[model samples]
Target: MIGALLIILFSTKDVWAPDNINGLILLYNGDIETGSIVRVEEYNLLAYAIQTTLTQTVLEI
Candidate 1:
């Protein structure tokens, strides 16, 4: 959905700085205090977010 599209659009290497695009994906969906922080590349973050989104959509069906 929108989140996936945003991830793909922002993931373009030539258009965006990887350092500036760094972010955290809440592993538990909420309750951030319990989640662990792991360093990852920008592309990896985008891929992981897209994958998680798609998986959730599929599971919802």
Candidate 2:
């Protein structure tokens, strides 16, 4: 059950250059990732994060 959730989570689409507000994402594994959440669509949520090291991470909400 957990594995399936992970697969679904990682499989969701990523948002880029979003025009929205910042929010926090609480994962099922007790990990938290923050980013600007554009919005939630159909079965997926979209967000993007830029790190201090000049790296970017895009994830589903």
Candidate 3:
């Protein structure tokens, strides 16, 4: 199925920070509260946003 294929491409990393956490803390935060960020090599600054459980449900089109 397409679902299984998508999981294969994710960059799996164990994250631990105050702003948020994932993988291990999947329950209380609603099934899954995953996040990803990018850093522009020219600026050397990072930015990210949480793909919250609610937003995902509405945008699953």
Candidate 4:
């Protein structure tokens, strides 16, 4: 019974791992980025996501 329980626990964790594909940059939380998500680097302890936006200024000079 113990062996079966262990297997079930491990399998459940693996299923959760692949589901969450998004990650946040801890230091730069306020900064907005533009472009599509290219990749994610788990080995480097980093999460990468991209977004797209136009560069413009609201204030008239």
The global C-alpha lDDT for each of the candidates, from Candidate 1 onward, is 0.37, 0.43, 0.43, 0.41
Best by TM-score: 2
RMSD in order of candidates: 14.4, 14.1, 11.4, 13.2
RMSD of 3: 11.4
Q: What is the Å distance of residue 61 in model 3 from its true position?
A: 28
In terms of lDDT, which candidate is stronger, 1 or 4? 4
Name the regions of candidate 2 deviating beyond 4 angstroms.
Answer: 13-21, 24-61
lDDT for 14 (candidate 2) = 50
Which of 1 and 2 is ahead in TM-score?
Answer: 2
Per-candidate TM-score against the hidden true structure: 0.22, 0.25, 0.22, 0.24
Looking at model 1, residue 39 earns an lDDT score of 33
Better of 1 and 2 by lDDT: 2
lDDT of 2 by residue, 1-61 (tens): 9999877766753542121112222233324345544555775665554321213345553
In the range 7-48, model 4's lDDT, one tens digit per residue, is 887889766544332223321453435432333355433333
